[model samples]
Target: MIPPAVLRRLNSLTGRSAPITLHGTVTPRMTVLASVSLATFLVAGMAATQFRSQPLPPSNRLARDEALRKSVNQLEDQNRALKTRVQTLQADVKAGEDESARRSGAAQEVKAQLDEQKTFAGLTALHGPGLTVLLHDGTDPNSSVDKSLGWTIHYQDLQDIVNVLWASGAEAIAVNGQRIVPSTAFHYAGVNILVNNASRLSGPYTVIALGDPPALAGGVGNPDQLAELKSRNRIYGLGFSWLRSTRLSVPVYDATFLVKYAQPLG
Candidate 1:
């Protein structure tokens, strides 16, 4: 309880620099109540701010978790499918290799059979140690054809020489690069003789026989063979040369012969 004149003097000294100007004296109880109310409001505001920044609700959280789980499951399924496809491709590769191996083996077997057939059929050329028979005309080109007294080699004389060589165990025979086979035959059209009906070997014929060289040459030394050759030598004036060699090549048979009287054995 201050006097009015004293209070006016105190206000005059303060000079209007205060937040609130009190006309009455301050009370302890009122001040305490005001502080408590202000503290409670600040605390409530802080709680509201914290609540606004909190995590999402249970429904939204569950939805996010379900979506992530489904994505993971889809990735796992895709990985499994890729693994299955890889395994299938590996199996296919292995199968292809096996089939190629089978085909390769079959091709080799067929080639072997074909080689054997060619050898047996005399379609393939042969080379071995044997004898060579060379026959030449006795009449030179300077001599007249009629006056030379038919001094030329005949196909019959060549046939006799081949028969003698065959009896001497000649494995293969060729006359003037002409391969002789079981179906071979000679044709005489005047002075020119066609061997095997496929080729016409001129004068100075080369008869190659593949076998034991000594045996084949000695075969021409037989009495009947020598007589057959000598008897023709007087009339035709033909020259014969029997030679033994370490290597002789017999040409391949080119003419095709179909046997109507024979069948293949199983």
Candidate 2:
């Protein structure tokens, strides 16, 4: 029922061939849509897989918390042990110090006891009022008179003076700065008089006897006996003197004794 021209135009439009499309070819818009859809799907799948693979938050959190608690407990135990060890060390140190102090005290006490014994033995230097006696040789004016008289200080003379001093209650006695002890001995070595095992004496011999000055003087008593001894000295041209002093200072002897033949008394 349409006009011929109109119909022919409609036929032309309908008969026009669609653009020849190459296999596997796509339009720009279609390619873009497909890429977007593929990207979306891939991203969604990856998200789902990640969700399934991941550990639960609470489970991870609890594991970490437990590990931390265990570490804290271990640390606390270690700290306690260390504290105990330190305390033990401190106690040991204190004990050692106490022991050291005790030993030091004992040593001091022993030293004090030894000092006391020495004082009691009259093996000490004496000061204060005392008397000094001198002995001289009679022969050479510097030596004893008769060669047969054994021209040096004799053991017998020393014995006599020591006995007299002891009888006089002398507190201390020294000969040439040598303290006299109960063990002290006088012996003759040839012509020389050996006192305390050493024999080298020269006049004037000095005997420091500590006692009451008056008592010491009285103890020496016989001036005639001394005079006769002096006469013997005159034959040798030797001289002697007796001096009484109120403030005499005698030095203590610090001699080391070596006992070979005697045993110590307990």
Candidate 3:
């Protein structure tokens, strides 16, 4: 049995107040064994507590993954929509370009037509191969051959020659540097013969026509075309000559339009 004083002292040191009873004889060895046994139990219990598994808190991983999936889907949808919009814009741009090209082509065609009209209206200068007809007064001053006007170049002679040139498909004609248009007038003005009513043509009038050189020359020199002129040239020594040229140029008509009441005939 342990002494009461010793047991109380042991209780005071260990801070224990419960009653301690031993069945064996109280000995130092027994006390030591009891202390070691209590220590081992406390150590084992602490170790068990330290290594014990605990339930984990609820996980948000599944929710986070779902949110990420939704975000990626939204981004994909936006990308697809952008692609569609881009394709539509590209088609529209292509259509616009095509329309612009078509308008440009039409504008070019219209410009070409206007230029052709201007050329045909004698508003533009012309240059090509053709013939030059020269007419002058006759040298013979005989009273019988002259008949007061037979020896001199007249407006009728000019009119006849111009008609022949026209029949020969002359593209352009000029008299003494004056362009002959559809409105040109060939008539007598006092003692001098007037051409285009703007120029008084003197002797040796030069008439230039733009056409096939050989054709124009042949048309002017044809006896059938100028039968009366040929007879007069033989009878009264009237001067008439025609020559072919590789290059010829006709000036643009400089006179103003004077047809006030007259509309286009054809």
Highest lDDT model number: 3
Best of the candidates, TM-score? 3
The TM-score-based order of candidates, best leading, equals 3, 1, 2
Model 1 scores worst on lDDT over the 10 consecutive residues at 1-10
The sequence of per-residue lDDT tens digits that candidate 3 reaches over residues 137-245 is 8765656644666778888888888888988989999888988887888888887878776778777788999999888888988878988887778877898899999
- lDDT: the better of candidates 1 and 2: 1
What is the Cα-based TM-score of model 2?
A: 0.47
Q: Model-by-model lDDT, in order?
A: 0.78, 0.70, 0.83
User: 52 in model 2: Cα distance from truth in Å?
Assistant: 78
Per-residue lDDT tens digits of candidate 2, residues 1-266? 22344434444544755432235667787766755665576567679888999886767889999999999999999999999999999999999999999999999999999987877565555578889888766553333443455445666777777777777777788777777777678777765666666544445578888788778777776564445454555555554567889877666655546578989689
Winner of 1 and 3 under lDDT? 3
What's the lDDT for residue 252 in model 2?
62
- True-structure lDDT of candidate 3: 0.83
Task: Quote the RMSD, in angstroms, for model 1.
Answer: 10.7
RMSD of model 2 against the true structure? 13.2
